[model samples]
Target: MQRRDFAAALTAALAAPAVLGATPAHADERSGGGLSRRMRAALAAELDDQDTARTVVPYLQDIGFDWHPETIAPERLDFIVAYGFGNRPPAGGGDPAKVLPEPGPVNEELADTVARIRRRRTVPVYAQWEIARFLESKYRMKNVTSIEPVIAPDGTITYLSTDGVAAQVAEARKHVPGGIGTAGVVGFRDHVKRCVQTTRDRGMTAYAPRGFEMPGTYDPESGQAWTRRRDLYVVHDMAAQWQVLRQKLIAQAYPNG
Candidate 1:
């Protein structure tokens, strides 16, 4: 074909829409909301310190429990509300510790604390696991999960729980066309081990969920890896145990949509 005719045909073909056979028609998706369009395309995924109050003194209320996010101190957060779920009760630090043996007394203390706080007016709270999930789903990192005590600024007592799942993309860099590198499982271990040691180093108490094993950090000490249940850690948390009733008790469990 003549050069002009060939060029015209090529241009027409290039402009065609991609249905059965069409090319791209618009600008590529951009990264947003903690996700690169590519990373988000892959799977879809996609914060603290304090130690002022410890000996969280308690008073006794009759039924439910409550505690100020901080003792004799204010907090940046009002309650551990999820950024996305404006109305739903964000998981983590809502009520007292539930898994304790003979929880009645513990529950009593929590109830009493709430009552005392009520006498004051209101209380603030720190949120937990849901935040983690938000991060994971946002980032799309398949190999990371975090479940930690959502301690109030007081630093001593943890009223709510938080959990998050990590997106574990295997060898994502080597696999993802272009990325940092193949630092997936190996890097994951290095971090987890470091985290476990750090958690112990800071003297954070063992808050692993009941029956579920306290996930060991990647122990170079034993020169071994942890058991494979990254999913359990990623997707679950301590607060999964207590039903909403515990939070509501006599009061309604504050319906969540």
Candidate 2:
């Protein structure tokens, strides 16, 4: 799809009542099955739209996928929270040390951004899982705390999620004066929205930088290699968004659960 056409579609989609984030009143009418089916049908339609693939490329670029860092006023932030990316252990067992994941490209980028921001003005940074360790050991960042994942006795990570991280941050904020004030949510460009939303759900006002500045003149949607990479990133982002919606529907259906 042409860039202009993609923008139009996106604008229309945003204005639509059935946009991804809106919750229907009857979401739990069928024990969540009603909303689930509706979302599945919407996703099916999105998949069938030929322009979706082409449009997503530009959408990601517009959303700062190429890493145009935002102007962050550190003084406004009470604290910063960095989310983990691809830092989970493998499902199939292997050497524990080898299976332990290090920060991926996204996390590394987040670390670098957070580290730079810290240099300007120091603030407490709470990172999930290995990111906390990475910041402390590699960047030597002080006052960095790790939000550990819940692990079952069988060695499986039971509750390593964005919501889990935000919950921990919310609890910790109780000690901070003014509590849950403005917070910086650091993560990949595409993942930042969900991070900000989850953080807000936990009662913290959150904002994410545009992301690490795209080094030099590299355009993520221009070249063939970059285009393919952006497509994959968009696909993964869409799936992640779907998961968030699914979880929201489940919660609405079973608030006690």
Best by TM-score: 2
Residues 162-233, model 1: lDDT tens digits: 122111111122233333221101112212222222222222221111121112232222211221244443
Ten-residue stretch with the least lDDT total in model 2: 214-223
TM-score of 1: 0.16
Q: Which lDDT values do the candidates have, in the order given?
A: 0.24, 0.60
Q: How do the residues 1-21 of candidate 2 rate in per-residue lDDT, one tens digit apiece?
A: 345554555444333335433
Please report how far candidate 2 places residue 166 from its true position, in Å. Answer: 1.3
* TM-score, predicted candidate 2 vs. hidden true structure: 0.58
Index of the highest-lDDT prediction: 2
RMSD of 1: 25.7
Q: Report backbone clashes per prediction.
A: 31, 1
Off by over 4 Å in 1: 1-32, 36-39, 44-101, 104-109, 122-234, 237-257
